[model samples]
Target chain A: MLTDSDSRNISIRAFRIDGRDNVATLLDPAAPGDRLKLLGDTELSAAPASPAGNEPCPEETPAPVLAALEPIPAGHKIALRDIESGEDIIKYGVVIGRAAAPIRRGHLVHIPLIRSLYDERSGHLDPETGKPKDISYE
Target chain B: MNNKTLSWPAYPRKDGRKGIRNILLIVYTVKCAEFVARKIAASFDCPDVQVTGFDGCTDNQYAVNLLISLIRHPNVGAVLTVGLGCEYVQAKWLSDIAAAEDKPSKSICIQDAGGTGASVREGISWCRGTLEFLSSAQTVPMTFSELVVGAECGGSDYTSGLAGNVVAGRFFDRLVDAGGTAIFEEIVEAIGLKSLLVQRAATPAAAAQLADVYDKMLDYCRSVGQYSISPGNFAGGLSTIEEKSMGAVIKSGSRPIQGVIKVSQKPPGKGLWLLDSTPDPHPVQFGITNPNDSEGLTALTSAGAHIVFLVTGRGSVVGSAVAPCIKITGNSSTFGRMSEDIDFNASEVLDGTCSMAQLTDRLVNVVIETASGKLTKAEKLGHFESWVPYKYQDTGSAGTRRCEGTE
Candidate 1:
């Protein structure tokens, strides 16, 4: 049973679709130092401490919380754990892309930082506009 | 599971099909007749009068079959076919098919009618009289069991999988449970999930069919060196085609897929169906499949969908010709920005203000309202965008006969 205060703190700011997922999706625009509560895959709620205070945690956690490392837009991915460079970025329990550089826990996971395995052009896109930088029809 | 009683007033057709709209469809046989057809439709200034047709002068069996299906669509009360006299796809042949279906139809050739002006004048006259005649057509009560709904997603973002498609999936489950039919297309979008798709087949035969379609689509993508993904999908936080596929397939719900039906082929005793618009395997691949969102919607409309759902996480402003498209977006901001074009906002589920079931119930209410003569935003705004591209697909024994040229 959750206390009223604990229940009040249970805001779903991000969602993890599968248990093996290394990334979660942000439901709202998040800024640095903002703590986001995770939803979905309740089995993974008991993993461990999420890179914060070292005090002994409660046995039954309301929801796992993570701190944002940067300004991430809504509907974007956030790393649930520290992902090494060239490692697979897992979401929906499947490999969506490979990390181009070492990504810290709670850091934003997106294009240029991550490259698609099938399409090499995924990494060669303009960061601001998300369009291919080298292609021209004319 | 709510067991809500769903029913609507429908324009009953001679073939025992029920329609939510009584439209006077204008068919242009070739590009030459397009201007006259548009003028005739615009002269009425009524949403019920709409234009759709093939632009090719050359013979393509696929295009002819698609046109025939549109003419026989239950929503179209009457049809008027316009041609440029020399086109292989004769307007008279199309009008004859419509007449055979017990619909009042007419055909006018631009060359035979003396010019574009004469053709437009005659088409407008026929439309005016047909609209008046269809106004008095009796409507009967239609139940949920009689409904066939199709779903397609476009301009997808991360919220599409988490919220938009999830709500649609839950609604599809409910609709299927209530004994209604549901269809979802874009097999090319279901990349890296062949086994999952095959596992959801309702029958062993359907499972085999799904496996074959999946393999063919994968090969087609490889041969063309292009998956169905786009830069907008990447901008929207989708990393790869696999991630997008995982999200796109959720709109099919958990219902066992009945079987794979070709484009323009109606579902054979449907609960849930997968429409394969991909070209048949050939030594040489020709046209692109589902080049745009409107093409996908038009394919679904040709498959006898009484109502179609267009789920857009980023937002879209398109509707189909025969079926009223209900646009839905899961991104609340996108919905806010495009509220006039988007119909339902599934972001309530993401905001924790409502559960998925609650959102699905609300979506069901929207569907029922749209089916009960409520004009969708697209219909109100007159956004009946349709596309009929020349594509090659094996038109199996699905009742669409090969065109043997106009008599």
Candidate 2:
């Protein structure tokens, strides 16, 4: 999962999909020139002219990054950002669905709905140490 | 194992097989004659009998294989296949398979009966007789080793590898220790672990057979131009096929891979196994087609499993027709999202709330109870989704040949 420092680790503009994705979609409306910070540390210069191949973000502009990405098609999951179709989808840092479609820099991905029965998270804190509680809900 | 005693009311069978329920089944040869199949089952209460779907094709070998396996399931006391007469799959073939097991079966075609109405009436009469025969069956005391348990993890997340699978693995180890059979399938996930698996073989021949099964699966996946690392596993935080495999393979517990089996073959002895599910990989958008966990469970049941221990991370609303699928959930969030579908939640292992041994013991008791006749979430909800075999375009032209130069 590690890479060389010379390789700039960019933040997903709303999300940068792969480290090597050609372009990133804009979550917020940006003027011709906007200074953006990268996620991982490798320095790179943004093109003066917005890179070509910018499609309209799935959602309206002026929204926060992750929020701005719109839902993709049903049963077809999209790349979180720009990613190759063969690459895995990393949500909550786990595999839920595979990338069924190629993602643009900012195109939203949709997760197929499988009927799940449980959704509760542990909130029990250890009374003695005040640490998060470990408990079996059912 | 001593802390608790699992119990349930089971139907004792003539072959010494134990069943949680006795069901008269109305099977169909094709989608075309589904109406006749339903009419046969509709004459009785749902509890007494139910209709299960399986389309028999003229040339789909896998479909024929599945139908034959399903018809002989211990849960099915008697069966009747409704054929449309002109279809490729013959009623006689199906009946012969069922009859070979000494199970009562009949086939009626709409064309032979003069029409759908007459066929339905004939089917209903046959089913009624089957139901009467099933009702006379009794419960027999079957030993633990008489059961062949199948393990599967789907809708997986991190906990799937960490806990859900581990729990199943523990059960698998215990099942083997107790002299029962256990099967772990979806061979694509067993990649990279072959060395470790081969090490578990009881004999050299078994080890070589295990390696061959892995080779076939590896070859099949490479030929289809499909990556063995499912996009779902990658999205779920698994990095490589190996990482996904490490998690997926844990479901077999630490039992030896006794003998490799094909989708249609039953496990011949007690121990671990890898079933070849490498028929064909469906495209990512649609996900690969697999037998409903229940259908696979039924195959294991026909192979002689009395019950199944199912584990899930993503969670599914699923149940089996013959063996009860006692689902254990692994993902903390998903366990919360689908509590109803889950019978046991091992998500605590992720948070360190519960030790692995503690969860394993809990799961073992659940299996015992399920075998004794407890209804699983899927069984209760009536989720009977089964899949047909995957079909390739050319049915094995040179295009489907295994690649030469890849691992």
Q: What tens-digit string does per-residue lDDT give for candidate 2 at A36-125? A: 222211111111111112332222122122322443221122233465664444321223234444655434443222110111111122
Write model 1 residue lDDT over B1-407, tens digit each, in one string: 35546577899888888999999999999998999999999988778999999998996877888999999999999999999999899999999999999999999999999997888889888888999999999999988888889999998888888888877877888889988899998888887666677777789888878877877777677768788888777776777777788788879887888988887888889599999888776665555766889999999999999888999987899988999999989889999999999999998877767877788889999988988999999999998888888887887832122222111
**All candidates' lDDT scores?**
0.82, 0.57
Give the per-residue Cα lDDT of candidate 2 at A110: 31
Which ten-residue region of model 1 chain B has the weakest summed lDDT? B398-407
Task: Write down the lDDT that model 1 would get.
Answer: 0.82
**Candidate 1 clash pair list:** none
TM-score of chain B of each: 0.96, 0.86
Q: Which stretches of candidate 1 lie over 4 Å from their true place?
A: A1-12, A18-20, A40-63, A83-90, A93-104, A111-138, B1-5, B283-287, B397-407
CA error at residue B370 for candidate 1, angstroms: 1.1
**Alpha-carbon lDDT of model 2:** 0.57
- Give fnat of each prediction, in order: 0.37, 0.00
> DockQ scores for all the models shown?
0.25, 0.02
